[model samples]
Every structure is written in C-alpha cells, then in structure tokens.
Target chain A: MQNENLYKELLRRFRLKVTLTRLHVLDVLANTPVALSHADITEQLAEYDIDKVTLYRTLNAFTKCGLAHKVATEDRNWLYALHMPDDAPSEVTSDHAHFVCDECERIYCLPMETGNNTRDIKEEQGFVIRSQEYRLHGTCPECHTQFSQQ
Target chain B: MQNENLYKELLRRFRLKVTLTRLHVLDVLANTPVALSHADITEQLAEYDIDKVTLYRTLNAFTKCGLAHKVATEDRNWLYALHMPDDAPSEVTSDHAHFVCDECERIYCLPMETGNNTRDIKEEQGFVIRSQEYRLHGTCPECHTQFSQQ
Candidate 1:
C-alpha cells in the first residue's frame, strides 16, 4: 500500500485522528522489515520534529489498537512493528512470533500460522487466556555464519 | 536454600562481588513468586537503603549471568525473577513461560516444561534455533472473576 493511503486508512480503522506523527510512525514502521525501538523511531523521525514522549504514546496507541505489535528483546529493549488489521484476527490477538538475533539484537517477524492454540493451552492448564506472544532468540543467519567461521 | 547461602553461592557462581545491593536483589527475586519490575524491586527493597540505580544495575547483571530472567509484558514493562542454577538447563535457557494478566498487569511464572522444542520447530522451518521465550497474556483469575461480575 502507498504510504499516504495506508496511513489514513489505518487511522480511520483504529478510530485515531489523522496526525502527522501518527502518519510518520506508520511510514517508518511500514518502511522497515525489522522491528524498531522507541529510540530508533525518535532518531529516524527526528527530522519530522516529533518528540520522544509523543512518539512513545503514538506507538503505544498503535500497538493497543492492533495497528502494530511490540517486540521485546533479551536486553529489555522494546521494539515496534506494523501489523495491519488483517494480520491479527479476533481469535488470535497476536498470531505472529518474533525471531530475535541475540548477537545483533534485531527482531524478525515470522510468517504466523493461524489458529493460535495458546488460548486452549492456558485453558487446559486451568487459566483463562487473553492473548499470547512468542519470541525466539538466537543467532540469525548472518551471526550464525560468523560464529561458525570463528 | 536459605537467603544467606543462596546469595553467596549465586554470586560466586556468577563471579560477581557479594554486596548488599546484589544480595538484596537476590533476596527480592527469591522471595517473590512473580517476576518483579525495577520499580517493584525498588519499592520492595526501599527500607534496605538500596538506591534505584543500583537496584536496576543489579537486576541487569543477574539477567546477563542467568541468575534471573527478565519478563517483558505487553505494556513493555520489564520484570525480573530468580532462575535457580538447577531450573534452566543449558538446553533451554528459559525453560519457563509467564502468564501476564491484562487487567491487573501481574506476571505469574508458570512451572516450566523441560526440553523446549522451539529450536526444533524453527529448524523444521529452516531457521536455526537459538533460544525461545513464550509469554501468555490474558486476564488472571481475579481479573476474570471481576470482569465477569461487571
């Protein structure tokens, strides 16, 4: 989708106002394949005159509304990624998983399989399930290659 | 193990200096059934005169050496809990998963299932396995009960 239309439509869907910061955040997240941290966005969007607190709130709003997903790393760093309305159906609040490279600290979004059985898993354990997140941390191909070479 | 031995042996194994701050962190984590955030630890250890920055550093060092596991919630809050030397075998760096209550925002550490096959699952997908973290986000029984009542 084009940046302009994608931004406007997403805001409408999420019932959020159409603002430059929101649009810029979507553009930045949409432009990247890997997840981004708040610092990353602040640095990336610095030219747009967006402040850190607003960027934080914008990302939080986006994640809450399913317009984006939050990525958490081993270092306790949080990253965000775009997840369109279609990516997560009502049944699976977060159907996708993250592949985190322990060496590089990058997060990769994996192709998610539908029908999240996590809800069932928790229910079977006698706990009610609300949502789920799965993250795999390790060396990516590049890091694995370098490690093997060493 | 008692607090005295647990703190001393854990510090020795991690090759860290035994200090009040470090010992306080261990005690705080050891005493809690749930993972704690930096604020939680600060509040819990307030009377001990441990400053917030020192408490934060202690938690970071513990997580790095595997003395504790950092739990990241959906809201991007990081929590810490003890990982006894016996709990996480090298095969599964984090053998357990957490159940985070969306309403009350508490993280419950679930008894881990040993020999996590996430590595194998990713290998089947042609991605090299490194480490894995699984988090379940939902309402706790208390919240669930309250919500149903409402």
Candidate 2:
C-alpha cells in the first residue's frame, strides 16, 4: 500500500490522530520483516527531526491504542510491529507465531491458518484472558537444510 | 530450599563459578515471585555492595549460561527469574506460560502441564525451531472476581 493510504487506514483502525510522527513510525514498522526496537526505529529515523522522548511517547501511544504490537526477544528488548485489528487476521499481525532464525538472526512472522482462539482453553482453565502472544526461536529452513547437508 | 542451598545448586546446575556477587543475585531472584528488571534487582540488593554495571553483567551472565530467564514487559524493561531444569516444570521458569495481571501489573508464571512439543509443527513447516515461549495477558482470578463483584 502507498504511504498515504496506509497512514490514513492505520489512523482510522487505531482511532489515532493523523500525526506525521505516528504515521512515519507506523510506516517503518509496516515495512520491517522483524519487529524493531525503539532505538532501532530511532536509528532508522536518524535523518528525521524527532527526539528520543517523542519517539518513546509516540510508540507508547501506538501501543495503547492498538496500532502496534510488542514482542520481546532473548535480549529482552521490546520490539514493536504493526498490529492487526482483533476482528481481522490476515498475512500479518498478532494472529501468527514468531520464528527467529538463529543462523541469519532474522525474524519471520509465520502466518497462522486460524486465529489463536483459546476460548475453550480459557473456559476450561477459567481464565479471564484477553490476549496471547507466542514466540519461537530456531534456525530457518535454509539454515536447517544447510546444517543437515554439512 | 534454603538460600545457601539454592545458591550452590544454581551454580552447579548452570556450571557457573560460585562468587558472592552471583550468589547474591541468585538469592534475589529466588525470593522474587516474578522476573525482575536490573533496576528492580538493584533495589532489592540495596543492602549489598554490588554496583549497577556489575548487576547488569551478572544478570547477563546468569541468562547466558541458562541459570535464569529474562522477560520484557510492556515498559521495555528486562525482568529476571530462575529457569528450571528441562525435566522439571516449575512456577519460576520458562517451563510455563506467563500471565500478567492487567489491573495490578503483576506477572505470574503458571506451570504448564505438557511441554509445548513443536517438533511436528517444525517438521510440517520445515523450520528447525530451538525454543518457544508463550505469554498471556489478562486479569488473574482474584482480580477477575473482584472486578466482577463491582
């Protein structure tokens, strides 16, 4: 999608105001394969006229309103990615499992065939659960095959 | 286990050399109900003479050798907890699902009945996965009941 359309749609979906900073941050996350940390997002926006405090505030805002999702890696760095609407599960978003490639050190969002519907489990366990995030660490397919060949 | 026993066993389990700093850090995590951040650990060890850099280094060493587990909350701070042996499922380790109480902001590690065996999924998906961590966010039973009563 074009930057302008994506910005407008994200603003509408998240009930956030159409500020340039918010839109720019959203754009960076949308294009990233792996979730980016706050420092990472800042590094990417080094050319832009934004400060650390503002970036932190904007990211917090995106998270509070559900425009973005957060994932933590082994380093315990909180990485941010664009979140999909709770009602909609597509190729992206929180519905899928996260796979990190050990060899390449890249992260992939493995799309799920179905939404992580845990109603039955929650009912059985009697948990008033609201959300779930699953993270997997491993070698990617290429690395697997390469290692097997060696 | 007593503090001394825990410290000794932790060093042995993780093949780590025993030091007063390491023992003190492990002692702090053993007493904490949830994973703690570097700052939190520092605060807990205020009576001790450990410096901030040493605290950070000790936490990293503990995590690297599998003596403890690190988790990041929404605030982007790293929290530490002792990791259990793979054969034993415990309340403090990575052998369970993490549930964060939304109202109180307290984190709970619920013991999982079965290990999340992902070999089949990895085979079907053709990815060589190393590990997985599951996280859930919602109200704990106490909070749930209290909120419902209102």
Candidate achieving the largest TM-score: 1
Q: Which sections of candidate 2 miss by over 4 Å?
A: A1-3, A19-24, A38-57, A86-96, A111-127, A142-150, B1-3, B86-96, B112-119, B145-150
Runs of candidate 1 with Cα error greater than 4 angstroms are A1-3, A17-21, A42-54, A87-92, A114-121, A145-150, B1-3, B87-92, B114-121, B124-126, B145-150
Model 1 lDDT per residue over B14-130, tens place: 778998788777887888778889988888877887877787788888888877777776556788888786643233265567888777788988764445445566667545665
Q: Provide the lDDT at B97 for model 1.
A: 73
Worst 10 residues of 2 chain B by lDDT: B87-96
Q: Residue B35 in model 2: shift from native, Å?
A: 2.1
Writing each residue's lDDT as its tens digit, candidate 2 over B1-150 gives: 367876886687676788888888888888877777888788878988689998988888887877777777866677777776654332332344566667877676555434344535765778776656666777777788788999
Q: Give DockQ per model, in order.
A: 0.45, 0.45
Q: What is the TM-score of chain A alone in each candidate?
A: 0.81, 0.73
The global C-alpha lDDT for each of the candidates, from Candidate 1 onward, is 0.75, 0.70
